[model samples]
Target chain A: MARLSSENLETAYEIIARYPVKKSALIPLLHLAQEQDGWVTDVAMAHIAELVEVTPAEVIGTCTFYEMFKRKPVGKYVVNICTNISCQLLGGEELLHHAEQKLAIKAGATTADGLFTIEDVECIAACTEAPCLQVNYRYFHKITHGEFDSLIDDLKAGTRDEIPAHGTLAKVRQHIPAARRAGAVAPTDRAEPVWLIRNRQEGAS
Target chain B: MTMNDVPKIITSRFDQGDAHTLDGYRRTHGYEGLAAALEKTPQQVADEVKAASLLGRGGAGFPAGIKWTLAPANVWPRYLVVNGDESEPGTYKDRMLLERDPHQLIEGVLIACYAVGCGQAFLYIRGEMAHAQERMAAALNEAYAAGFVGKNILGTDFSVDVVLHWGAGAYIVGEETALIESLEGNRGMPRLKPPFFPAAKGLYMQPTIVNNVETLSNLPWIIRNGVDEWNKLGAETSKGTRVFAVSGHVNNPGVFEVEFGVTTFRDIIFDPKFAGGIRGGKALKAFIPGGASAPWFYEEHLDLPLEKVAIDRAGSMLGSGAIVVMDEDTDMVKAALRLVRFFARESCGKCTPCREGTTWMEKIMQRILDGHGRPEDVALLMDTADNISVDFMWPPRMTTICPLGQSATTPIASAVMRFKDEFERYVGGPIELNVTVKGAAFIGPPTRKKEGSGV
Candidate 1:
């Protein structure tokens, strides 16, 4: 069965340690699983379930609820085009059409060479930068047809080194130093909150 | 006064390219609020913010300080969850804050943590915001390294830790309770209020104060300069400057900070320094006073001040501080369909009315847009909207649990009622079906393909 690599397991443990309840780490762990592979596999879900101490069905339930997590295999680059109200007003629909024609695949389909996937997404919070597209979650705001084509060309030719693969949300991972961590003990392990004990002591004094 | 005359409090460091960096932030009076806040007791800090009357910029316009004081007194381990999961259709101010001046937000988070007696704060950014997440994460790490966060911040007794959590693309998580649910590794479905209010019983069954990123970003300025200075700005009820993210058919569509209650919808849309009027010198047909959820406002309503009360009286809200202008050329029917389709897609499917009703509304609107509208289709759209929201009035009476149901009704009700003639034009026989995919944007049970139809 597919599982997180040893290094990824270590990083997963670090993330789980940040939350009081280990289950709170479920989303981040799922992201990590996706990061390991482009799409989340059943075995990866099972692995995350075991790590987060939830059932595979529970994991799948949470996973399916979000729009980002892909169940099936996808291309390396996921091109999400915003076609909501603001973007639509500024030719978002036209851009989506243009992308479909350019890529020779439909909105939800991956390319024949398994390099790119186009999706007509809703608002991605960049309303000001209308008609925006994100390749592997990296933004290309206010893109024209020419810019988009050039971007695609760059992606195909491996010239756009700034953009990463589909699952990589950020190139720079967050690191919390040991001294700075808020005691991420399991909630059940504590009789009462640590702050409560301090508060009680201060009040009594 | 114009926007230039208004002080840029929260967005002070926006133009500074290095504001996201620790050094850049320090050079520009950063962390001064945190310093000022630490000098006062937590109660004192809370009191000052309450006095300042800083309203939440994440839509609802509730006072941030008042929200902080609502938690049961001395509730240990009270959590401060910053709502950076900003995916509102026309809202992007929070995104700018996240990407540009993350340290400012971090400082605000630290101050808010101290004020609310929280030992830990969870910063939930949106999944699609990769740049924002990176900027915020980098800023947070720099802050921790500099001792602004985690364990005796700035050599003071007060210590707070902020965990950076990103959502997996659920707009429903923007709702406070749904955000809490998402934080707890559950499906991002909103829990019913009364028993499940975050202030009373929240994350891990303890008290939590969920604040908008923009709301928290105000804390530093208020704390540094004092409430008197803050009170000098804005109107009587709504105090402080608000970051208005203006978009759509405008010449210069971007985020601008203006003193709240002073500016009008017209000033925001037409002012040279702001949106710079509509694109292509076109006449304004209609504009969303706020985010997509608010009812559309026409040219007559342009004079209304950008105040919560004034806009509310005019039958719409300055929701999420997003102003999307629509020009004369925009097809009202198609525009309504665009927004309706958004609500339907992002309904979260928790409540039956919102899930089913929004889909129905989207379908009917799509059918009309597809030139296959029946004569009664407009009434059908209104009927479906009425079913979702008990009435088409402002502050809609909802049949569903969350406001998402009522939000679906706004575009249809606003568009159909105001421009009945335009909706009528799409009716009768098949007009030019420009849309390639019939009902492709909507989500529901798939219909059988019609002959020669673009399915």
Candidate 2:
């Protein structure tokens, strides 16, 4: 519902510079928007469309095509469990069921308190570590029921809260020189990159 | 010679100490190939690769050497697009290479760029591979800082820039043109062929050469090892070793590098050295010889050699060199559903057949697996698959814009064709939706409560 704060807009321009064409930055910008909000909100998509000079429909098209971009709001952590052939063969389905029961919700549901959202994702290419799952895109390999239970406990206690919210890319915000030039990228069009020092609260779910 | 006797080639540094680091890579015959390639003309480099007969390690198994050779002269500023969208269900080899030994891929990129006279290259890594992306991005930065990727690499007139792009998560993007589309920041939909073929016209409507991560990763070895040495390996027509991402119902499910025709599905799935036979001594039921794109191979085909010619002759593919094995306890109907679900979700809505056909098959599979089916459902699935590609006619025949139609159809057609009894059992039975079946548990819903859906 809210637009990216002023500081993130500066980061947007810099990301665009990384590509020869600004449109190529769409996926990255969507990632940036996600970092701002827990999911890619409709307003955020519109804002991204303006930034990349594409129609909102085009943004929606690309965004919907991707399974990672959540159009609707999700919990603080999105637990994506790969249930593909490899995962299925080696306890991936059972893991999903376990998570569902553990969280008191089904495969695609978020907890009532909005702390976690469980997803039965496809193969993440980590077949060797069969019962693997990712929390906010960070992999947990060879996971077991006990490990998952402990992880959930850590998440609840905020001990495993080192990772930022579901939408955030990295816990730290970087203010670097522009790729094309040396000048510090000022907040553009009055939008700015949410600096770590200022927006520490934003990363909190 | 046995598989172990063959040169390690690209996968040698897999387990070495700190292999991910640049220093670790350089110490172990890493970029020597780039240095060697820098001394030769682009044409000479292309000729050497062609002579070596290095086929594309991606799904197509096309000649990697000839791909570079096919870059048309009329199009200035040719581009090299590396397919790193390793989303095919069983394939994860590229993820390992990108995360562990990305410098090798970079050196190969530099060589391929030099050989193809291209000044720009883009590695479109899968969105799900966040760690692989981080490693590759870090590796690219190191390569640039070290003067390997930027202007006048190794102090020559040649200058090339590499842009490391990320896909949002479209399996279809692995299909070169769709990759180009996603790289351009559009919905990753496959473009119609003839005019849209990548070599002749691609990426901003310019000539381009798209190679797989493994295909380009092999370049450094080809340039350094010499063509004759490369040719001596592998069966005729297909040269060089490929990294097979073996998973599912095996003792040691992991990535293995092997020469073409040197081994068989039986060896990879059953040999102690490879997958080490199906897990818990379970009887091997079926396997996907390639990634999801290839057809299913049954017990009768276990001895079939893992090669392009052999696989093609058996009516399947060596696609992406991903072999996912299954055991007797697995449900064939549910397995087909898993693959169809993937295809349906990843269809991209670009073509009529792929977009609609995959979804239709998914619905039917869900119904059948949920204990609501008729005898005609099996025939209907095969019939629909036939309409989708009808044996994957090449040169833009009966297929859709890309091979995705065939990819969507392959598993279903092959599964129903090989194991009709399984489908029949599910069909004529009562609607007993067993949510307890571990591997097949995620097949359908009512599995999820409506309002509780996070998205």
| Among all candidates shown, the one with the greatest TM-score | 1
Restricted to chain B, the TM-score per model reads: 0.93, 0.91
lDDT of 2 by residue, B1-455 (tens): 78779888888888886777778888988689999987776667888988887889888888888777676664565677899998888887999899889999999888887877665677888877777877887777777766677666766656666777777777888888888888888888878888898887887776778999998888888888888888788888778788898888888988888887667777887788888997787888778888877767676667667777766655667888888888899888888898889888878887888888999999989999998877777667766766786543321135677877768776676566556668878888423221121111111222333321221
lDDT tens digits, residue span A1-205, model 1: 3699999999999888888888888998888888889888999999999998989999999999999999998999999999998999999999999999999999999998999999999888788899998998888899899989999998999998888788888666677898875555332342444433554576579
Q: How would you class the docking of model 2? A: incorrect
TM-score of 1: 0.94
Worst 10 residues of 1 chain B by lDDT: B435-444
For candidate 1 chain A, the 10 contiguous residues with the lowest summed lDDT are A185-194
The chain A TM-scores for the candidates, taken one by one, are 0.91, 0.82
For each candidate, what TM-score against the reference?
A: 0.94, 0.88
lDDT of 1 at B112: 87
Interface RMSD of each: 2.5, 10.6
> B438, model 1: CA deviation in Å?
32
Clashing residue pairs in candidate 1 (N, C-alpha, C atoms within 3 angstroms): none
Q: Where is model 2 more than 4 Å wrong at Cα?
A: A5-7, A169-205, B391-397, B429-455
